[model samples]
Target: MQRDKAYVIKHYKKSLDWINNLRGLSEEQWRTPIAPGKWSVAEVIGHLPPWDMFVLNHRIPFLLTDERLPKGPDVAHLNTMAAKKSREQAMEETLNDFISTRRQLLQTIQQWTNEQWQHSFKIGQSEMTIIDYFVGLINHDLHHFSQIQNVIHV
Candidate 1:
């Protein structure tokens, strides 16, 4: 029932690959400067956690909780905080959180229908559907994935 199963799965596979590639790196490798003054792989991983967790745990479920967007724009701040930690700590907790939440996000996507993908709902300032948010998530990942590769010199 996924509207575009091929498209979804393709991106899903690509995302999974990018995540896995990071996981395969050693702790030092993860913290290596991936870009000039951007963020290391560990920080990038830390940055990804909320994309899934906030969407699943707060935003979607809290459709009635409040109009406030969940896990809004504080991620850069969070990444800054996580970056302060040693690579070991960031990878263990922050990176793992991304893996956990992404697992949940993929699981959630499995239950969606094509129509459900774009079903509009009100949130904060504008009306958008789950699909819009999910698309944002995908794009965010891709954009950062590029940054990660650049930083890691991979």
Candidate 2:
């Protein structure tokens, strides 16, 4: 993939449209579970913001620095924490946080130089570019969106 600004912006725009589809869902719909052991639509939606915040605060900054990047955060643990926090929040509030944090991340990304987008962040013995990192996040959003759609339609 090219992994350019336009590509990243496309994903960001698509995310907003996808999220808009969740608006106005009934309280019951929002609370619907994906499967027997899975998180509800609300909790899945709530899980996204902090990861974006992490991208903005920790991942991106560490990558921008010339210093060696540390190991990635424990995503499973973060998700567990985020899901628990979301479980107590209203659907509207969680959705709003998702929208706000995503937009903020997008805005921050929009200002980056091409070099920054192409900059490689070391992970273990390998490296991944900033744009690649964002693509992973986009996939993460889509994964949750699909989960929400499946549960909502059931």
Each candidate's number of clashing pairs is 3, 0
Model 2: what TM-score? 0.89
lDDT of 2 by residue, 31-130 (tens): 8888888788888888889988887887777877778765667989999998998899887788889889989988888889888888877767767888
Task: For residue 108, give model 1's deviation from the true position in Å.
Answer: 1.3
- lDDT per model vs. reference: 0.66, 0.81
- For each candidate, give its TM-score against the true structure: 0.74, 0.89
Worst 10 residues of 1 by lDDT: 62-71
lDDT of 1 at 72: 66
- Write model 1 residue lDDT over 1-154, tens digit each, in one string: 4425346656766676667666667777887776676567776677666556667777766543335565465766666665665354756566557667777777777676777665676665678666666666677887878877776655
**Residue 22 error, candidate 2, Å:** 1.2
